[model samples]
Target: MTESFPTVPLDGAPGMPLIGFGTWLMSGSECYEAVRTALDAGYRHLDTAAIYRNEPEVGRALRDSGVDRDEVFVTTKLPPPRADQADQVLAGSLDALGVDAVDLWLVHWPPGGARPDVWERFVAAREAGRARAIGVSNYSLEQVDELTGATGVTPQVNQVSWAPPLYDPAVEAGHRDRGVVLEGYSPFKNTDLGDPVLREVADAHGVTPAQVVLRWHVEHGVVVIPKSATPERIRANLAIDGFSLSDDEVARIDGLAEV
Candidate 1:
């Protein structure tokens, strides 16, 4: 069921699912249970961060869920402040997750917004096999280019706060042109689900506006990680694969962007 989910091919790793389960503010049992439910709901991709301080819970859920580690796409991040201790911090993350390496590792944010030095450490992790792929979060296109210029290694992904209201075709094009996969977070928190356009589209498809928003991301090839603790919603988020939006529907949602 997971193998057929829409995915974006990565250079040296398994294809990343277009839709994933994001664990940001969640922690403790809440985080673990939510992840278990997500995996059971057919979410093969899971996104967590060191700063989120829930890798242990996420790992526990993964192990307890009985999903083959190789079958699940797991991602974690490095806090910018840990740039000087990248090796140690990553070691800790690996130990906590009980994995030899993460499918993807990201610099949580740019250190001073231009630390190719940190990116270098990320490259080292990948080369050393501690990370299958390397990337950055909360980065601008210029910053992404700066790192690439400095290290000669382009980050495989860039995660940012993305939603229909925050959409920009030029930005998406920039990532595409540079060969960076754009991953979005907070799909619901960042969107106004009550918007008329979303409602109209949802009504037509017999799905909620939230599902339409998620499907919208996949339509553009942008990876989306929607976080939810509710069991029903966890399953519902992954249900987006059953239907697709028309080009007209996509354009209508794109028009919701303040950009």
Candidate 2:
């Protein structure tokens, strides 16, 4: 079955596939097969991290899948603790992924309570063609301003754990003003799949609660990376293009957020 995947405007960077396959807490052969399956299922964007310790497996799958390198958007992160080794870490990541450069590279987190310096190194990597676009994950507004102030190169993306209860409109708007796309991790909140509001929306649409949450991310204009190892779930996750929620339904899901 051909799936119509959505594309999101990624600031100055190339357009990002709206739904990316996230590889967190998945490793070894399991990671390899899952990635292969996702690609075969038409997932063009893949999200991984240096901390995940499975880039090699993910890389193997990519190579074995025979998909052209440029056709797939591969993203990886650098552990915050390796702030000083940003350049070296990026090289290692490239080696593991068996690629000369990654589509996107991120500083996994704010490091040493100071992110500007780490961000500067990321800027260097971008200049050296180690990564096509550089960004941060789990960063606050202050950190975003600090990095832009120091490097004058605003991040192309800022990934964070954004769901109903934890969604921060101010942060989202701040990044948008700076031309940084918000990539939401853990859109399902790792639980709450059975929440009454989400269940109602899912039943109304005749889809799964997971699809409702992912659609929420898409409507909010945030990029999303939902991880799954099951082939059926992977296919189900990508099946969100046929339906949309009404304004009332969206407000209902937004209202489910706890203050």
Candidate 3:
């Protein structure tokens, strides 16, 4: 059975679903089905990007799910190459997704355009009501500061690669001090779920290792989007609300970092 998912508040809009379903490599009918399955499994947040080239499929799934558009929180990204044409790029995404406005729009990566210039365009999108909230992905602390310092507009969220193996308290503190919500992607890429420590925690909670790791992110207040096309994993990923990780357990995973 699917579990009830919760939400985390953003700076300028309604709260975002804490656990989002990610569609990175998925496309065509597979992407549509994955999204449909995710929504049916109780996932209210869906994350996609222009680079994925799956917006239309995702939009179709959303329409077929019988779920009200307002009930689901959708996030799509702006690639760096389109930074100069931010307005057109976002419009194209909206058209592809068949949505009037996305709940949150993000800059997919940092290398395409000048950080300040790109961020300014993103801010313009929010101002134009094309996106309810705007943020950045794959940005470092310095770049995040540069955007705010230059444009006087801070990004509401920073989506980056974060996992037990690469978690850094200092960098995370920087995000918190800047009032940026740390939304983590590729959460399962950096760690070995089969590690005895993680397995032991999973055993204790009678859940999977992935659930243990996701719960750890929850306890730290980080938004996690775990991608999976399988229905069983989709349901399992959102079933994290029923358990709580001990402070000691969280510290153990924190201390297990290789970097």
Candidate 4:
């Protein structure tokens, strides 16, 4: 069920899959089965976090899916409390995920003054080969700049909440200026699929509103991770490559940001 996907190159690491599967608000057997479903539906990039408390389930699913270890791009985060103890935190994550190294390891959040110190450790983790790439999430542009200034290393990726309605040119510019990839979470959560614009675009493309939104993110050069427990929706989200939205349609959807 593997499908070809565009990859964003890392400065000195492996390329990341553009479309990733997210695991959040899912746990135990539910999380296990959902991970299996996502893998079966052609998703090669998987996003999880220590705070999510489902790494074992996700790890089990990875082993059970029969997908090659190198073929799949796995990303996990370091909890805020362990930000200063990145080595120990990553060791715990590795044990939880049952892997020696993760493709990407991110600092879940910035904890004020300690952020710089934590970021330095994350950089050390990358240098030590515990993570192929290092980055941060829920970080502001200024914070990102500060980290780079303090450590002399820009993050490979900056993950944030993004959707048609949450589009911000400033954020895009910030990432672009520093060669950081913009990864979007909650791609469909904040969006209303029933909105006239989404529905109209979806109808014209003969696809679902969810697909329209996912396609918009893909076309905009943003990496999107959409979480879903439904099997049909998981497959539908990947079918976005079949349709293309015109510039006018992209703008129309962009207008939703102000609505």
Candidate 5:
């Protein structure tokens, strides 16, 4: 099918959209409406998790959106400390989402000392076709390497809390070297929209700070999933294409990084 959303090719699997709708803090009917609004607003990627306790609602939204299943990319995460139960957890996620298989599946966090076993289970689930693409979240550079080393299966993507203060060039570069894509969650860093710097950029681009931040993520080749429940904001978020930031503008935001 012709792609309805801007896509970033996964290292192994098919392409994923540069921006995805996140359902982290939303729940109940709220999540359903938010996700439905997002889909209506042209968002083709949806990020949810088993622990979020809202998969059923999200699934309902997807079904109600009138969009074809093949056109949308649905991503969900495995609950923490469930290395041994990866298969079962994924099964439940699929059942709740009312999908035969997820487009991408992620480990919410590295299982610390249990990472090796957890990774094994993750690989098994992927191999079983329960998850089309498998990756990790909140994993440091060291942990990413460890998982890849243990399983000999590189992650297709690594979702992390990436913002100006927390962006790590070294880690990003390492993942790139290993052919892993970096997906940024919480791309806004809870920054106020009224912030002067972001506002300035927004004004320059005739867009909002949220757009500037999301655009920055795209410019840097990061896949971003930002959560919002407001219809206007959801529409505004997907309207990030068609603008480009200059090298200096990109650098200015990078300088805002806190060590």
Candidate 6:
């Protein structure tokens, strides 16, 4: 929507930025500062989870950034333990994040394997206008099917740990068939950035291998959230929009799955 970065259309239909800032281990002032740095670097999407216990810091940075709430896409997840009190947990997240409604809300994991009971509350929250869109994380396509079958409501997105080495065409196709947007976390953690293929492609694009990896995710239209506490890497990671990858290059990267 900002036109600064590409976005994938969400389920009920809204543009979610292809790149988002991930907050996993960051906390306190470090979380605050990194989030501030990310916002200053033109990141319009922010991902945080209740389990991270840093939603308040993330919220603080967003407010301090002076960016209008509507201009940013915010996501928070419900931890498994809080599944029974889903509504209260969402309320607490809202209070911590200082927002009335989050752009997206997710079930952190399977929560006892596709617990539709938790999903039913998510559906109610959406209807109550507490969240704009809802989805799941670390869910198999079958689990997604189970939720949908139980409630007739399919998750809009599925967030998982992904990178080139883990690429599976069938898994990608499965989400497409289900009309679910795929979001990938731990992009660098799961990648071999030093691999020659990545090095060669990075050289071709005049970027770092990490940049090439991030661009690869965007190339496949998969949402990637690369996190960093360092100022330079934070900005460098968001600098991938300047170049486009060749078809051959993408094929080579995809082939990394076999190697």
Score every model by TM-score.
0.98, 0.95, 0.96, 0.96, 0.95, 0.98
Q: Worst 10-residue stretch by lDDT in candidate 6?
A: 6-15
Q: Give model 5's TM-score versus the native structure.
A: 0.95
Model 4 quality (TM-score): 0.96
Question: Distance (Å) between predicted and true CA of 209, model 4?
Answer: 0.7
Q: What pairs collide in candidate 4?
A: none
lDDT of each: 0.92, 0.85, 0.88, 0.88, 0.84, 0.93
Q: Which candidate do you rate higher for lDDT, 4 or 5?
A: 4
User: What is residue 75's positional error in candidate 4, in angstroms?
Assistant: 0.6
Model 1 Cα lDDT, one tens digit per residue, 162-242: 999999999999999999999998899989999999999999999999999999999999999999999999999999877
The sequence of per-residue lDDT tens digits that candidate 5 reaches over residues 22-131 is: 99989998999999899888888999999999999999999999998878888999888666688888889999999988889998987664287787777777778777
Residue ranges of candidate 1 with Cα displaced over 4 Å: 1-4
Ten contiguous residues with the weakest lDDT in model 3:
1-10
Cα lDDT for residue 30, model 1? 95
lDDT of 6: 0.93
Clashing pairs in 5: 164-257, 165-258
**Per-residue error at 114 for model 1, in Å?**
1.9
lDDT of 2 by residue, 90-155 (tens): 999999999988989998988865468778888778878878888889888788888888778888
Candidate 3 C-alpha lDDT tens digits along 1-259: 1224668787666688889999999999889999999998888889999999999999999999998888888999988877788889999999999999998999888955437887888887888888989999998888888888899999899999989988899978999999999999988887799989999999999999999999989999999999998888888988898899999999998987886
Error of 3 at 20 (Å): 0.3
Return the number of clashes found in candidate 5. 2
Stronger candidate by lDDT (2 vs 5): 2
For candidate 1, the per-residue lDDT at 13 reads 88
Q: How does candidate 2 fare on TM-score?
A: 0.95
Off by over 4 Å in 6: 11-13
